[model samples]
Target: MKSLLLSVSITASLLLSPLVSAKDITPIQKKQLTEISGLLRDNPELINPLHSNLKQYLDGQKSLETILKTNHDYLYNNPQQPYFGAENPKLTIINFTDYNCPYCKRLESGLVGVIKKYPEIRVVNVLLPFQQRMIPGLKTNTAWYALNVWENDHSKFAEVHRLMMAKPSRHDSSSIMKIAELTKTQKDLTPNQKKMALVEKNEQIFSQLGLRGTPSLIIGNEIIPGFIPQEDLEKMIAKQL
Candidate 1:
């Protein structure tokens, strides 16, 4: 009985492993899975914990969906949010990004491609600088600087945003301020209470949605967390359209 329980636990863990996919399973593994499935059927109580955990996860996801729906206007249509794409778009997706996150950097090109392909879609940029810290000379935060540039001068925001995103390493106050200077957004880089408030608001919304990390996206009613490939992104957008 003890050995049987151990096998069940191992099999369950293996089944749940992200590294193990259907195509990777061998014939012997398939036979083992079949045997495990039979065991699970016979001893239904063995799976109660797994079932309960899965139910909890699904419930949490549903709750997040509700939150997203509730805050739809503030997230997608707020005038304060900096966005790129069509001036008047049929679809709008919100991006929760951190300047220092490499995954967010990787996802940037994909997002740009999506925008180019779907001229009627808009992507709102929500700066959540989780990894940034205050530098001595810079009066404001890196993300806050970007937000300020966007608000004060919309024309320079794109170049400022691009320079920051293109940095090979994490952005410091100096690097960000240099980009601001280069783009002539330095004048607006002074600390602004309103931009700080907007950044805080974005963080609050990110928390409300239960997002774990940067590069998360909101497409339609679905809240996609983490980096998504351009091809898959297009597919998701197509479905929405």
Candidate 2:
């Protein structure tokens, strides 16, 4: 009986581990476990298998928690990235996007609405520019140049960003030059190696975060991949909060 009780307790602890600290089990799960404990006391033979299953569940939960926390911290405090929103925000959403992605363009309105609705939401935009690879002969230089322009003159970054977002289909050098001229964004005649390095770093970060596409948002510990409606976005934020 004592051994059976130990197994039951171990199983209960694993099930409840993700949602609370080891020292603090919630009342509902505690109550439910207590009831299960009484029944499990008669079935001592089941303890070993149940213990193994419980260990697996706890291990998976720990892995996921570690990932979320690591990602959140990486996105939140990375001084090298560009983000615009709440100052000293309570909620940070890391946004991976490409200027040439239509889905990212589509998501812009809803993302803007989220920031307006929640004064504490910070949207960190990480330029993955994977779309550049699709264009024949382009070496993903647009985003690299954009980042360079942003560093040179932050006050003009928004105008440059808007132009790039507006002209996703245009891959012609002249068209890019036109947009750059309009925003006074083309400072370097050649590919600025440092900015391209930053882009590479961001791409590595995107891959490390297990993202395959654009318009992926990291809200709290959760990653909302692809285009999501404003209502769904709100619900996700509410859940995290």
Candidate 3:
């Protein structure tokens, strides 16, 4: 254990060195950090500093990975996915969110604000309701409702999304359906077969990406998880562009 701590300290030092940038951490170091993160997950004492360094390294490396591994055709070009903003956008942000997540709601507002400011950015919103630990089954209904609305009439999506996020109510099917009715999207989904299938597909996509949780975003090659300020989001977009 002492040897392990020494190794992590050494790696952390390298990350902090004046000459060593995020890109300087080679593939081997990434693997090492990843392993250490997993091993230290149960050790609360050592996890904080280790995770901080790991996050720094990951932030630097994700852009490069995005360039190499991003499936633009699947994420950006797919006609079936719902997106908003400039038709011809300089940057695209693939956002994974859940209606049940407070952080997702916060991020949603931030994203909308940013989009309004920078009309050249496009946002592809993906629903992953089950990602929230606070509310489990309720996410299915909200995700289905949102997707149903998008599938039926994308023109109404923006309004429906805002309503769904804005309505202060408990996370449940009844509340979700009420919001849908208010948004005039209740009729868009019934029998729940097609919409539920699409919801499942979205869930699968989220899982396949190995995303950590709601409010996660794919901006270019960088995977940003959790709620980030609108200003920071703009900066990330600017960096990509």
Leading candidate by TM-score: 1
Pairs that collide, model 3: none
76-178 in candidate 1: lDDT tens per residue?
7888888999888888889999888899999999999999899999999998878875645667777787777887898888988889889978876678767
Select the stronger candidate by lDDT from 1 and 2. 1
Better TM-score candidate (2, 3): 2
Instruction: Please give the TM-score that candidate 1 achieves against the real structure.
Output: 0.77
- TM per prediction: 0.77, 0.70, 0.68
Residues 40-80 of candidate 3: C-alpha lDDT, one tens digit per residue: 77566776666676666666456445542555676677666
Off by over 4 Å in 1: 1-41, 46-51
The alpha-carbon lDDT assigned to residue 3 of candidate 3 equals 70
Pairs that collide in candidate 2 are none
Q: Which candidate wins on lDDT?
A: 1
Q: How many clashing pairs in candidate 3?
A: 0
